[model samples]
Target: PWSSRYGRRNRYGPSPTVKVATPRDIRAFFMESESMPRSDYLSFPNRDTIDDTIADMQALAEQVLLKVDKTIEDQIPPPTAVLEDELPLHYDGLELTNGVTTVFMFSFPDMDIILPQVDIYGWTPDVMSSGVFDISSGNAVAWEDENLRVGLWLHSGWNQTAKMLQQYLELNDARYRREVWTMDEFLETNVIGSKVFIQQYDSFRNAKIVAAVRVPPEGVYAVASHVMDLATYLEETYPGHGFEKIIDRSDVLMIYFCGRQLTGEKAHPDLPTAQQSRFIIALVPEGS
Candidate 1:
């Protein structure tokens, strides 16, 4: 089981309920909390690069939003510069490709464990895969080999994490048409072939979008290993409740996301550590 300070709860007594704030809420907090150090690392594009894409899809009555990965700080050095098509890597080596997927967002302040929340809209397949549909012509097309994507939310006490986890499971079940597991299932099946766990530049900023449209079997195995590790950690840290009934229902397969492993500590001095954090739950396609 993975051990960390995050696992050990209040040693003195039962902790208070932590109010998990939304990204919009966090953005608001950042605006108000002058004392809180500004996250200089949070970068926004100057122009709306996807305006045309948005306009083209507007006829479909869809709202356009930006997908951001909080782990960018761990990937690139100071003055992070990534091309629009670039995909950043997650700590688990899943490449942050361009597609719709669910994400978990959380905040931790002064031991206030702001548990993760499901953000289905933050990055959904239909929304993330821009240019795939032509609203004007009312036609849908498959995405090219090269594409990239990004995106998450919050909840309470120890039950907070559980609740959020449940929400994520439910949302994923409804949205995605595939088998998803929480990690335990991978171990049970022994399908996790390759494991890559090292503290390095495993952030979104460092990842490049997958040049290929379809991920091969090797790619699937690499991601499954990380998913398995996360599941084991979650199971050990928060045992019982059958891990929101997701892990118990797993087939041990995995879906790959933004991660391309890099080596060594490429820490940025200006960026404040722990600005925001996220946990990912993915859908594993079988026959990997």
Candidate 2:
């Protein structure tokens, strides 16, 4: 694991050890139904069933991991050094076969359409320019933290959104052979590499993208953000929840819907808890 001592000062205390999901774990997602095959689940599942499918994929991953030969050390070496506030770009690549062909697609979210967001109307300059940007660019599924709770906002429809992304990638996989990337990439530089990584991830699931937020000076704790569009939608959705307003939808700023639900046993379920409360995500090409 890339230690926190390598990055910015630990005023937040020891950085929580975030468990990164491996490529195999991601591959396991596409392997949910042998009858349907990998692409079948990755590209065609409906939203209503996406979450259940994601769970099924996770369960299968656990089984696959249980059979791994742990005694055999990984051939990949860990990073000896890294840029400040950057995660060691370590990776373990796996050939995610569609059981037939491995391809990738790159479309939608024209970069020309996404420009840097400058000052907002009345707020301090901090909101537009503080902390690392877009923590979850290519995250097809939410990750779990050390607390065994989820790491990103997930509600009834987000899983469907995730599956939609998976399907979107499969739709254009006809051009590539394989993919490679790490889920921990954001731990190093949260904002800069997002768009490009997501582009590749969507093309081939090369990177392990997930909902990411930084740590507070007080240290790691659970938090959530509801970056959504439409006034009526927000009014209807957050009827009884307690959350602060981060941003209002505008032509310049795009909003993504993200939030957390209380699990019976867990205290904090939000992933990548950080100092910054708002997580600036990359351009989402598709969603629910």
Candidate 3:
């Protein structure tokens, strides 16, 4: 969409810097599970299609396993047992209540600790970053673009991480309840009012907060520059973890893992200044 309005004058300069994830890359994820010691076959579902299972033993003799993240490996939950006899016919052999999938998590400074699989009550938005994974297909469950395939999902997922940011709002409103907003109208209302709207999304603080907005090609820079500034602020506020804007699509969806209710504390001290008002207001649930 940005390309259409601006005639695609290399909006962000060269091609998108964010590398899209591919199906092959997703398939390789299985290798990590394969190397893990399994107590039973069900622990690692879909075993028959593993590369090692179909590869010649001689050819694999000299190969070594890729290193897995020790933190994730150590924290992987054990399989839960299900009593099939006690279940109804439709539910037979289906571990509906107990299924496991790997998700990415991030730790940030001045942020509460997040435990993805362990926090069953959803009291805290413990998982800072993660994507829905399709266990049966061994692929990421996300939006797909013709050119990027699964990469669109990965890029969009990353782009959406702004939802987790701790925002400092000088003003608030009740009207930002929609899932999508036009960039021009959003800026006209919230930015001009110096307001950030996100109060009605979910009563629970830990619920996932997602918002999207569409910007015309001509006005793309108006929003993008502020977003990049926020990205920079995020990097400065939280060390080690930083935001990357690799996608320049007109419709942008942002996701935030709500930690406690929205707080008055500024994510960074410099936010909401006269020039940064748009940046601060844009971080609300109304998108863009």
Candidate 4:
């Protein structure tokens, strides 16, 4: 059971009725009404002069609209420079004890936007007590990998962010889609086998992927391990749920779990400690 600061309430005992306008009265009122102009119309000097003035005003309006568009575009930091300088990294010797390397990639569109930071919590009880692996560790690369994996699993919804951003930019500039790509599709197609790519949607038509390596859970070996198990369980127990199998071996496995744990020996539900979790693992074809 989950609890929140705000909860819904329902009142059952309510009885009140009031009569207002009848259908006959409403129909008679509308039948006697007449259509009228909202305001008095002003007459222009001459047809020729009115046409000339209208054309001039139209040109001025177009210029003003263009200037506003340029001003908004200027505020968004350009992605061309950031993408050129920061490329994805690949590692070889740094392997986790579980034999699987977790890779994470984060994308940022502009310098003004703040990217999400990562925090790693181990399965051990002593891990949190020492405060060693919390969010504020100087090891950004390590934390980034962990948090990126967690983000991929926890924030797994249909690519609404990409779609909303696309619609917004296209409203002002018709050429937006040619440069902008969906973040979900970009990660799914590009970094499938090598790393986990996670990113945020921004106002501009640009994106970035920050990459790092992570360690998998105790028994999990490859990215496909947990996914395969979950798929099998769903198929066997709840076949009616229509959970599909992983068609492409290149697809990554992202998982998120939320639960509560008992503190010490007390098992009170109201006082239990809450836990939130996320993990991402990449899977490649057997030969690849």
Candidate 5:
């Protein structure tokens, strides 16, 4: 407001004089502001300081996004990690754990029923083919020392039976005893029952381990099942088979030895298979 004066003021104590704006200056400024260079009147903070602050903020945002992406990436395991645990399950040195209930060893045979004691439900007599054991169902299990290519299921959610087999193969005994029925006994026994499950796999050298397991006709497990025409279902879903009849005379269920599920979904049929997903299912029936 003092700049309104026309005359200037002197510095105090007569230290060399200094001029200060008065009322006249303020009036002159308002009167000529429109014609004056506007930027001269409008001052902003230094440009370098503002630019540095904006750059700092952008860098901080980028760092935050990078950290978030890294954390999410670490949370999931790529499907390939299962390779070691899936094939040629060597139960002799297998570690023990109690969190899972059943275990299934595919790609090998345990006909003698040794090591934790499993009844043979399915066998591949072709020596070159993979064998399947109905290791456990609701807690039944078995173990053996045969040198075979085996995969063990170590956990239980839908496939509790598979976990039971894993426990035994690890040399840890399973106590629950469910009979390992031949297709004849199993079909005859459970045919009238309400719950039925079919597990499909991408069986191979480095087996996919578990392809899928669920109650059929209602869940995604429905991918490959038909009450009578199993061959077509297997071909469409798993895409390959080497079937053999197990129980030749079953009034209720016709059991067969289904061949291997190959390594990859799109892999060639002969590309080193793992589990016998069962085409029509060639079977070495129980007690044979």
Candidate 6:
């Protein structure tokens, strides 16, 4: 042995303290080897080599989040369907004809026509003079709440008539009410955007015809006057047929009288029995 004392111990406790590597330092040293090829870097072969790998991953996640937020903000969900399997169709436009205006028509192909159920009548002094029963103002005098009964009447008969006509056309049966003249429900439902006419039979006579036509966006005039003209035409053309009273008959004659001023017009020399007529007729034949 050379000098064992010199090699083993010196003046201090030991020659010098040899530094032992810490776990953190060893891990760091191994992590640096990730960039090399798999064969060259055995310690951390699959690990990322970047110093701030965690920060970079967080930044990329934030970018993805921003893109998702933008997509959600820009897009709107589509509206849900209300009437499933129903196709949108526009109704036919009606034309003013024969002095009478057609207001609406409700019919289906190979099916019976749906008659109107409502009508509205307007009241004025001129109409009162026309000898038509003025149901305008009633005696609400006792109940002092400014009781006003405007010239309005509910015609159930008219509604019944429409229903009866519909039934007749659909069932091919004539067993229906013959006295159904007016319909109040139909008047209330269909009387939209209508005009009130205070028609005078004669200026001096003070007689008036208070009526209104239910002017809908579609169809024929729902007025007694127009109905009467149609009925007359049907009776003339079809002759001795009860079809002149139904509302569903196509090819039924329709007469429209327009621009006939209500003042001082010689009592329509042609309509001699106008006074006796209580109801206007709208005729509909069985097969037509």
What digit string (tens of lDDT, one per residue) describes model 6 on residues 1-288?
A: 111101211123434322322323323322232122322211111121213366656654554454335343233221111122222111111111111111223332233343332222121111222222111111000000011111122211112213332332212123321122232223223221122121112211111111212211111122222222333443454343342343232322221111111111222232211111122222122222
On lDDT, the stronger of 1 and 5 is: 1
What value does the lDDT take at residue 236 in candidate 2? Answer: 45
Can you write out model 2's per-residue Cα lDDT over 62-107, one digit (the tens) per residue? 5445434244433222122222454322112211111112222223
1-288: candidate 4 lDDT, tens digit per residue: 001111111122234121122323322222221111211111111221122376656654554454345454443322111111222221222221111223233322321222233322211112222323221221111111211221122211112112222222112233222122242233334333332243223211112222212111221222223332333333353332222333222122332321121112222222211111112223322233
Q: Model 4: how far is 70 from its true place, Å?
A: 47
Model 3 lDDT per residue over 138-234, tens place: 2222211222211111111111222222121111243222222233344343333232221112321111112222222232223323322333443
> Model 1: runs farther than 4 Å from truth?
1-40, 43-228, 240-274, 285-288
The candidate that wins on TM-score is 4
Off by over 4 Å in 5: 1-159, 164-220, 224-228, 235-240, 244-282, 286-288
The global Cα lDDT (0 to 1) of model 6 is 0.23
Error of 6 at 222 (Å): 25
Q: Report how far residue 169 has shifted in candidate 3, in Å.
A: 11
TM-score of 4: 0.22
Q: Cα RMSD to native, each candidate?
A: 21.3, 22.6, 23.6, 25.2, 35.3, 43.8
Q: Distance (Å) between predicted and true CA of 89, model 5?
A: 32
Per-residue lDDT tens digits of candidate 5, residues 142-189? 111111212122112112233232222212113222222222232223
What lDDT is reached at residue 29 by model 5?
A: 27
lDDT of 5: 0.24
CA lDDT, every model vs. true structure = 0.25, 0.24, 0.23, 0.24, 0.24, 0.23
